[model samples]
Target: ASHGTVHPDNEDWTCFEQSASLDIKSFFGFESTVEKIAMKQYTSNIKKGKEIIEYYLKQLEEEGITFVPRWTPPVACKSESSTSHTRRPVSPAINIPDSATKEGLNNKEILNTSSSPSEPTAGTPDDKLDADYIKRYLGDLTPMQESCLIRLRQWLQETHKGKIPKDEHILRFLRARDFNIDKAREILCQSLTWRKQHQVDYILDTWNPPQVLQDYYAGGWHHHDKDGRPLYVLRLGQMDTKGLVRALGEEALLRYVLSINEEGLRRCEENTKVFGRPISSWTCLVDLEGLNMRHLWRPGVKALLRIIEVVEANYPETLGRLLILRAPRVFPVLWTLVSPFIDDNTRKKFLIYAGNDYQGPGGLLDYIDKEIIPDFLGGECMCEVPEGGLVPKSLYRTAEELENEDIKLWTETIYQSASVFKGAPHEVLIQIVDASSVITWDFDVCKGDIVFNIFHSKRAPQPPKKDSLGAHSITSPGGNNVQLIDKVWQLGRDYSMVESPLICKEGESVQGSHVTRWPGFYILQWKFHSMPACATTNLPRVDDVLASLQVSSHKCKVMYYTEVIGSEDFRGSMTSLESSHSGFSQLSAATTSSSQSHSSSMISR
Candidate 1:
């Protein structure tokens, strides 16, 4: 806290807000009343500052002091079929479509156009990247965001050693983290690692969803929605989840979904060209016509949860809308089972329609143009989407086989295992080089109750000299050994928590994330449920979990994996995205180091 600041004559106005000293009750006469109203009206003007600037610009145009630039393709005209925005969102006060065809805006014409604009304009690109050009072509973004994005991209180009993601791809992460370069970079790095590890980038070329998925997955892309966003229709209720999993297996299923997302990204690019506008995301219409108990297979549900995790982490803000129509009474049960894993931004897009409600104003009609609504939904359009068929049990491997394979694959990953005990917590130390990088963890509470927390320290915590004892390490009978956790950590003085404590139940696998706001050492701690009185002494070691959950009286067990991601990429050249916008805002709070735990504990994926 800085104190003893000096103030010059006019500095009083700069240092102390006049609003803080105003008193409405001190009106001594009619002059005071007038002053009160004047102040009220004056304050109101502050709210209209942006509008006033827009109005002033309009006035400037009227007065012939300023003139707007005209946008044109490098060629006198485009190819007959090229989709281009006729109206642009450059004025900041008005949203004009660059061009509109009955077909829709896909946001691709600007980037994919064969002829450069000599000078970029709204919905157009140029050979050279410029901030104003980006503002007019892509979405509106704050200068800070532009800088953060550029820095992140530059860092990636210089340091990352693998394939580089596109600027649009990087921007999505930046936007997801409210343009916090460190946070966004961390997220991107992790996703890139996951992609590389899973060979996700090649999915579009290598993945082949078996005939079973092609014939019975019951999902396909249709025409664009009214907003020019590409629309996808899914007969979720009619589709067989168990069948797909059996046919493809979890990894294959995950890979297939990744391919769909990859396809979606490509489609979104193509759609931008077709729509002649900025179409960053697609719309999903899910028809839950026949969802039931059979769809609730535990293995299938687990697979779905894993899929959600992969999608949420890699593809943020890709789904513009999720319109769930014709949901049944059992929908809640299914929603409850999988909703916990859904990101809040994605969850907000879900609009559930029960019975025939989708035909009304706040339902499908609100998103989809009525004329294009599929025939099954009581509309005239013929939906080519498949009517799914059932899959035979022969496609499924035995449950025991799947379980064995799952455990085998899980053990092969670079994850750590530890036993938790009452009072003692399992803690992992992560050191971050860049502030705002993300720290992520995936863990399963195999037994007992546990609490999870993450704290940050400016300096690495050293074992206390006052204890007069050396550090402790133990080896287990199974040849697995781990160090004992230091139990007496002071919360604020030594290390302040960056994330709130998370309470996890037994048998649950939890995945969570946090963005580091500053470069420092972070501690992720998992503690067993302990008696309040036994909280401060020596806690149990990681070997206890390896020894046997049964050996400890307060037995608790956890299998965990953690990683740190920085904000950079693996590529040789950096292509700065240049184009246009309406507005970009700073997020109001920290990214919260969360991909998000749950909308609630059990129901949101």
Candidate 2:
């Protein structure tokens, strides 16, 4: 056996045994015969070996084992057709790694050959191209992008709505977009110029003139030529001097004449007679009776007279009546100006028409009487005393007496003459008496009782001492006593008989008279039992009840005490009695409960 070639004697003839054991039936079967023929061809020359390998490869390709390769070529035999003609053998497949194997080669080659250069790239660009192609081919698109494009188109249409004209360029653009012509035209008409024209029309349609001012313009009182047209044609007549003189008076007429222009004066003079005098002079004589020459010849009136004199001097043939008739309105206007300068009495006389019973034109007399007189009187009239009014007579007399003095008395005796009176209430009179050092009284007709006491001597009396009655008494006329008393005990008793007490403790100094009959310690006892039962059980609180009782008692005491003191010399005595009386009253009052109700029957009448 040779290591380089086929072994002949070795028992391990695996290749020869495999070939020898092949069944003839298996060899004739489709795949096995081809394999057997391939083995015989491979054992011949190198070229034959390539041919056998190619033949097996072709058989394998037909059997669908396309991934397998034969590492040999197919054998080629020369043909007898031509000497230069040669057959080219089929090439064998080179050995490829398993990684290089390609199954389904026909489908792969078809895919590669069919693919174009224009095919899309990988990633986003491929996706975009696919989307675009689908849109172009299949008309598919995302709703969002479609909607955005629609909105943009709508906005463009609105923006250009009324701007484009119906011309070729615009029409071509519209035609390309398949837009409606009528809609385009309608939008175009909404251009700024068209809108502005409509706005102007709208404003004109609503315009209205002010009717009131138009009516005023038409009324003709404002007559004047405007723009060479007779716009307002009302004419005014010349003023009538006779009528104005009758209306405004002679002085006003004269002043008005003086104010007329030289042309007016000449016109007036031409209508007059040759006599040199103002037309107003004769008019004044006729209109006013007993017209005083002195009153008429004032400096202002004389200046006006000079104008008339000059006019008469210039035109010697001018007559008064002719001038008056021609310038009738001047005299009245002048009179109105001059009338205010006259003395009030003279003006009144002139306005009143002194000689005539007629009320004067324009009711001048009535106006003066009604309006002017009252105004003048208000300015000048003094306030006069009314009937039965008081007049002060003298400082020595009492106010009442002085007030009562007869007015005739001032006319009769110089010493008893009345001065201006100052009236006051009776209470005020009392206050005046109390304020003054010396008070005088006239008691000719006393309506009420005049209870009074004089001091024993002319000198001012000393304060009285407390007496045996526990009261303070002063000496009266004829040794009669007038007492000043604390009122608590005598509230319901005779007020005249009541007396004030002089209080003294046992063994204490007794400067004034004390009650000798009472033994032991006797204090000034002020027992106050309300005569009219307290009406204030309805009082809300203890303090209220106390207040009500105190107020009522104090008011009553003050009134009674004032009357008593006013009737006599009790001021000194009463002043001392007040403190002790108030203390005793308070003690007695506090002992009683405020809530205790007084019998209503006691307060009935």
TM-score of each: 0.49, 0.11
- lDDT of each residue in 36-105, candidate 2, tens digit only: 5654453343344445545765676578653322122255435322121111122111111111122312
Q: How does model 2 score by TM-score? A: 0.11
Error in Å for residue 217 of model 1:
0.9
lDDT of each: 0.60, 0.24
500: Cα error in model 2, Å: 73
Model 1 sits at a Cα RMSD from the real structure of: 20.1
Stretches off by above 4 angstroms in model 2 are 1-286, 289-298, 320-605
